[model samples]
Target: MMDEPNPPVWPDSVIIVHDTEDADTMKQKLEPTQDSWNAEHNTFTCDYHFSDRRYAVLFTPGIYRNVDLEVGYYVQVAGLGVTPNHVQFKGDGKGPHVPSLNRHIHKNSGTCLDTFWRSGENFSCANDMVWAVSQASPLRRVHCQKDLYLHDKDAYASGGHIANAVVDGHTHFGGQQQYLSRNVHFGKGASGGAWSMVYVGCGDNAPPNSATNTTITKTRVRVEKPYIAVYDDDKTKFQLRIPLVNDGTTDNLPQVTGDNEESRDFRHVKVATASESTRAIQKALDEGKDVVLTPGIYYLDQSLDVHKDNQVVLGLGLATLVSPVGSPCIRVAPGTAGVRIAGVMLEAPAVDPAKRKSTESHWSLLEYGCEGQTQADDPKNPGALFDIFCRVGGGGDADKRHWINIDSMVRIHSSHVIGDNLWLWRADHAELNPGESPNCPNVSPVFYQTEKDEYNVDTGIVVTGDNVTIYGLAVEHTSKHQTIWKGENGAVYFYQCEFPYDVDTDFGKAGYRGYFIGNSVKAHSLNSPGIYSNFRNATVQVETAIQHPDSPEIEVVNPFTVHLDNNGIIASVINGRGPAAQKQGVPSRV
Candidate 1:
């Protein structure tokens, strides 16, 4: 028999709470002050007087009745149980029972939960679950018996990541950039009511169809209702991969159809070493078989080209492709359809220690489509990427140095490309050195900061093709425009972006925007969005959230700005505030 995995050790920074305590005692322990009082003795409230500390609250198993809690930034609430349902938070109320009433609402605006559950009546709207979270804080391993609401009307909520969850009732993701993965159920009924899973924008008057850019992957529906619905205006902005299928049972781990077919469909080619990777992959492509890359770092002196149609390049755990200093990593030829690249990390070349301030020489790490391909609009055939992670720097001894100084991380020149769970990061958080002298020798803490005349990456994604769809696009800390969409009819669902944090005098002082839509573009869409910019030292500010002159139907739920110091300290924050739509010549909306 196999041994059960040991429970995760709670960090020392976590606060341990138990259900054995009375309501009053528990409230005091959570708030630690009377400045934010629990007026009804049921809701634990924390006001502005509360300290801004990153905290994790671990709850022992038990039911705490009639409890509603409020928290602020960088707080994580988790249940200490073998499974998510082992711990319960139940309340007495159902829908419309106002002030001092029956509903249990965890009115957390800027917080996170590892697992949040409530038990009472499964069908009652009164048993609603609500929270407002950001990208830095994600909800993991959560199972809620009640309907989940991202944000109430009053709070500005940006969407975060949700994984391995089960919701018995409807889930309303009304924030920006919400990504759902490996979820069991969402919405219970087929009717167009509160039981239907809906995504909407945050404006008070925004219609249910105002929600944009929400992505769902590897999720199933429990009931026979509309599995997923977007706002009338947001049809193209939502990307659905592995559609929510019903397996005719309540099994959380149901045997999904085609679950094992991916392995059989592709001809698995295992490359033993980095030296043989490029040649092996090319041979597989030539043989009209899909290539499977096992776990290892594959160094490429030249670009690995995919020319055939319906070719899939799959990778196992931690399989990475590293590019040389001045070469393209991977290229997809034009007119190629249904090409998939999944489960891999792409790394740009490491920065040379001797030329710390020199410019990088690559054009792009990954380029899709040939330069002169006919830009035809074809939805029937497309290129796709699943669970792809890309990094530009911070892979070696010294942290924060720009490894790949390219014009774009991903440049798409072809149409109808779909991306799921795409994360392009210019590493901001890492240890300078680990082992050697004290911690490490010759380590630089602020390598992300640009020196005079040093080369830097310009953008995360530059889309020149039409009808390109991305489910979860997260780009952080690029030098200039984070994402620039010039393509026609491009749809982006669930975009999570963060501006460079360690910008100082060494970094140049201007022209950085979270997203820049090209002026010539006519139709582009984005939904379920979160864009955060934290400026500490440099005067460079984003030109505008959206720069497209021909106003696209873009919906952003929460956009934030923070001012911090060079030492990574927050001085002030303007949360849930985005640029004016009218300034970009788009229709005025929040």
Candidate 2:
């Protein structure tokens, strides 16, 4: 038997709070006054759009009454309980409404549009909850007893995702351009979707099947990210919760403690703080430690290499990794097995002009294993990437830079890997002005400089691994193909993509494909994939939304493409097969 390891001594930034005598007291403990709270909670409310600080606020298993938890930028609020029901926010008639959890309302706009990089998981709200967020933010394993509103006001939201939760009331998607809900139970059902809405393996009042509102009755397999939870009986002991594989089932509870080895083995766990350097982090990984990154941005001077099996690198509060010199931030060594990376953002920041060659561009931000290093399939312990996001620009000084150089966001070369809730994006615009627009002007906007300027990302994801599975994936605004699949027997549950909007006349007539499968691949499958285009700079047409070999083994179900605006047209769905969706308000399918 493995020796028992010591419990993790969490950093000061991670706040652990228990039930108090009153809700007001608990709220005060969670967030003190605005000035002091910025230091204690790391809650940078003033820097709502971008901040380097990260924080994780954990609630111990208990019932709290009439407390409205306002989650701020880069803050993660989670419940430390065996199940979500154990931590309840109830209405005790001390306030106007039931206990609610909401995003920090921006002081200028009073909207949730820019509420990004924050998350809430494993908790229950007695009544209404507002989570008006865009990309890179996720809500998982949450139970909402009443209404769930997606928007706080009239501001527009780009996209969002929700998975593994139960909602007894209606979910209102107001002003959200798109959304994805997987493995959820909706008792009262969903109300609105502006562009696209997809439901996979959901139960109770499922949306009527349509091309726009796509619904998949069953999912083949789903493995959730491992989470940290306090022991229900002994609060002092923290156990790692490994989720069970969901085979089209509503709920497949994980194995109880004493039966799961991981629950007891913390010997290899290493809690990492943002103050440490990349050398320190690499040293911990070299010692075969699973590093837990606290809330903060890591500036990697060198790649953090992971070369072992079952090694986990978990991040809290949207912990970001930035490559300042145009190099990869994280790289899994060749033939490495079962390296799990979750809740992290890989960002390609502006490279210094002196440090970068004029003709050079970085290949990838995060790489899973090396190309052509084949190994036997490890289905039981596949390399898993959950809630992993990649970005080219749109935060910090990234928007002010004239050039951004990243060829691809992620490259997966290890066979039999699973990716869930992966979003690879190249920002099309910069942050808006904070003022209510009564006097403030639009400050910075991204513009194409020259032909050699790597303004936007070339691609989002490049997959060379066989038997790779992805769920709830979104790739947007790439200069080339959004996703390139080269291996055999790959499957995608739900895919949302948007082609580059700035394909100008100087660019050739040959447009980019959204999902491109190599001709050498024998088998692949896609379910409910949507590609949209909005060529605002020039009138252009893409030859195909998806390009794949037409074979019986290669199955594509319910694939559609739509022209969002500006005379952008996609001629075909896959291999010159489906109708085109041009002219506003029209959708075409294959």
Candidate 3:
């Protein structure tokens, strides 16, 4: 019999920072050129906000000194060990000195309002930390020695989700508008928030639902996101480990499927770059090779099919997949089980209708299964999508004629799928081209013109699958219902949504709901959902934020709605259960 060959080495972009490295060695590896290596002067940096590069920095299991890390756009930093305790960061003497996220350039000078697309996982920090970020960012399985601030100095921020983590000190929300903390151990509990703050399956010390906070003591079922870990004895070997589903257990430690015994070897993993075509990548997936997409943008003419069970598609440094020809970026086949997609962004690029293609717009950015549904493989072993962001706009130039629109951002046709930390946005605002906006210069106008309704998406998510579970989901600026669920046995832990800013009074009154569960559904669980509306285009009053039949099997908890500006009003939180949110800063809860 022939011996199996070793896989190819990793690319130059995947840098493994060792514990013994000094400043010079780090700079030599990270900063090939000053122009290319965009970072702030202090610590390990990647501060270029608009740069196109992607990077993944992995730290070996050990201690480190004088290394204050600062994460920036398109960067992912993680420990190579099995758990958070495998990698420890020594403090800078005064306080806990964990790696700080990229500083925000808007509002307050040094806040983290605009920090996005960076992640920290499976690591321990010695001192106090600040992670002020918005959507598309996640912190998982991290141990913080001191208090964690979600925002800096009360600056306006809209962050994000924290899961399966331990914070020894208080987790302060500060000026953050909304956030979710799931299955976490908050040592001193939590405080602060401008609009909504949710806690689900948290420690006993966590606060309960009140006038401002929304809390759920337990969840029905949850499967933590799968991750990559290195061997303790041989760090060269890597494996993708899928966790076991939790039966309402709130423990911070993740339970793997087989005590870490069952995992896929790195030799079978394919490291793909942006230069590779979609066909080549699809072929690799079809051949049962787990793929790692390095930091770059991939343009796909058709969907990248995920057909194999237990296959992993991991993206480092915000790997982006764009569909420019009105097709889905990725599609999972029917009855596939244990397929994981993590740390990836799916985008629908703008295309002119006259560009020799079908006049129809994009159907969806991502589809879990084909249009014809099938029974899921195993109820306990479902497919997973974590830290995935989907967008319908923001890719094309500022020309209105070329803007591409999508009907829906995500469509789930497979049963028993799990998702965490998803931000599906229709892009209320996008970066404008130089000639489009003279006054604002780089930023887009507040909203698109009313006549350009063809550029906006209709819905953010549509679920036709049964037994689906989602934790920490956000959908924004969709013209119709932000989320529509027509399946049974569905569970949503935390959902945040904003109505279309361009909707008029007549449309807002009769057009949409923030969350719509079809009357045919029998069993569902939804908790801590927040819906808001600004309606900058016209004064509008919505009838309800959520609409669902009052069935005994359906459970709704801590649903709330907010009117962000004076132009909009939410008449009831859900099914006429609460008072209207008429005031700008007030929230109506049920």
Candidate 4:
């Protein structure tokens, strides 16, 4: 909460501070710079991370007498026009309230996030912590969310869209920064200045999605700081304190099947509360029979580890096997080989106990997380395991939102294709301590070790062995991107596949990620740069920026900020940043 009083007017503001007064002089008198290290390249691999605590960033520091903001509340930049990148704003000029305008993409690549501050364009849609977003008009500016040069949340974005920003500070006299229909030029030494979007102005409104506004033909408008009285005096600024919902008892854990037989035929397989479902699955494997699951809710309180080779686990397409979103639904131990998984929609819940009520996504399936034995301490498990594919994650219980988790695979055919499915939750393995109260409820007691460690923390699907092949598979999420944990190496191959959402599918929480073994494959939905990597393409249609597909409620805004890293898809790298020649370069633009 900002307690500063609104002044008659805001004189000037600068996001980043510098010693020089004139930008042209600063440009002319500066030292030649090193190659610009695009943050996307690093951020893509850096895993999507969000600050638990609400935070705000200001390049230049300031004094405060009655500022009531907390650690999360940030200061602002002074000297509006000079330090940030140069931005071009367009306004309708008719009045304070104007019709909306059209939007366009930046053809050239220079309007990067970091450079935005220096560009004199305060359309900080990419990094919210640095500056603020506002809507300007003849009367005043409002602090509403709008697309701009830089995002206020400060995460890596796929395009140079400066529209998805909002005003964070006191509202003044600015509005959404509308861009020219034609590609405009943005010069260096002009990154963090304010700009305006047609018909849009500052307010507490949320950011809108990309749309067409054929009604207005304005050229541009410049952004300005709101009056000091615009400071928020009533609200509170706190970190995002929501925790993973936990189930007090591990009673919901699945019961393994390999240990029994009579239950295999589905006769006594069990129902919604039965614990023998796991035993039945195992019993079917022992008898070498395809275990047919009745189209009802089957409960196997713990993870259902498929240990039998050449086993088939079948489920009705409409039937659902609900698990707490983000919780491991089906797990394959390193001991299981020659596995064929398919036709089931598995989703973890935000609250484990709220199984039926939780609509979060699941981490679906994978061959295993051995990384073909290269990253695994046991060489026998190295890419040597034989695992197949499936038409899983597409089949949901009552809702279309589904999730699945798989590790390394031996040979994945279209059978394990993961076909078509709509997943809304994330495979987020994030959680609070076990001793603490459940972040949400019914969430698992398993602690999330996703802190870029050596432990096996892969969430979506981790495969670490050899001979991994993915053919004609489409993976995606409207809520968030999923991670495919590819450990130390890649015997991994993708053929005619699509990876579109590079901005959301990954959360580079780990150090290792081998996207491919065979260059013949294609991934279109590359979440953000590297992702937190979902997809688009020949086979799959993708939507949304970085987010948790299994998280239930889809974030409908223009990606305020996204967090990635499916520790599952990315495995451990034997060599940091790849071996030789593959040094650190953009794999494909992400």
Off by over 4 Å in 2: 1-9, 21-25, 29-47, 92-114, 151-155, 232-236, 244-261, 264-267, 324-326, 357-362, 398-400, 432-455, 506-508
Which of 1 and 4 is the better model by TM-score? 1
TM-score of 1: 0.56
Question: Relative to the true structure, how large is the alpha-carbon lDDT of every model?
Answer: 0.49, 0.72, 0.74, 0.24
lDDT of 3 by residue, 310-423 (tens): 888988878899865667888888889988888898887776556735665547888898766675658767888899898766534566523666689898888888888899
Is candidate 2 or 4 superior in TM-score? 2
Residue 479 miss distance in model 1 (angstroms): 0.5
Q: lDDT tens digits, residues 1-590, model 1?
A: 12212221223344556667887887766663112344565533323211222344456555666655544333435554434554567776222111111112434332222111111111112367654443333344456666676544334333344433556666555533344333334545111211112221111211234323222332222211100011123221111112222331344441222132222211133222344657766766666655545445678767878887766675532356886556567788888876777656677776555664456443777888866677434565567776566766653544434443656688889987777556777765433244523221122221223332223566888899987877557787777778988888777656667677656633323545677778787777665444555454454444344445545354333333332222322112112134332221122223
Q: What is the per-residue lDDT of model 4 for residues 449-509, given as tens digits with 9 covering 90 to 100?
A: 1211111112323333332322112222222223342222222111111122222323333
Q: CA RMSD for every model? A: 13.9, 5.1, 3.8, 24.6
TM-score, predicted candidate 3 vs. hidden true structure: 0.89
TM-score of each: 0.56, 0.85, 0.89, 0.27
TM-score of candidate 4 to 2 decimals: 0.27
Write one digit per residue (lDDT tens) for candidate 2, span 1-590.
23234567777778777765565666666553111134433333334454466788777888877766667667778887767777788874221111111223333333344456677888888877877777767888888888888765565576788887878899888777778887777879887876567787786466877765778776666677767777745565666666644444554322222233355345556777777889988888888877778777888888889888777888877788986465678888867777778988889877655666766654798888777676537776677888988878765443345556678999988887888899887876454334313111231121222222435678999989888998778998888889999989999887889887667643326546899999898899888788888777676777789988777899887888877777657888878888887767466787
Better of 2 and 4 by lDDT: 2
| Candidate 4 regions with alpha-carbon error over 4 angstroms | 1-278, 286-288, 324-327, 333-335, 352-459, 473-590
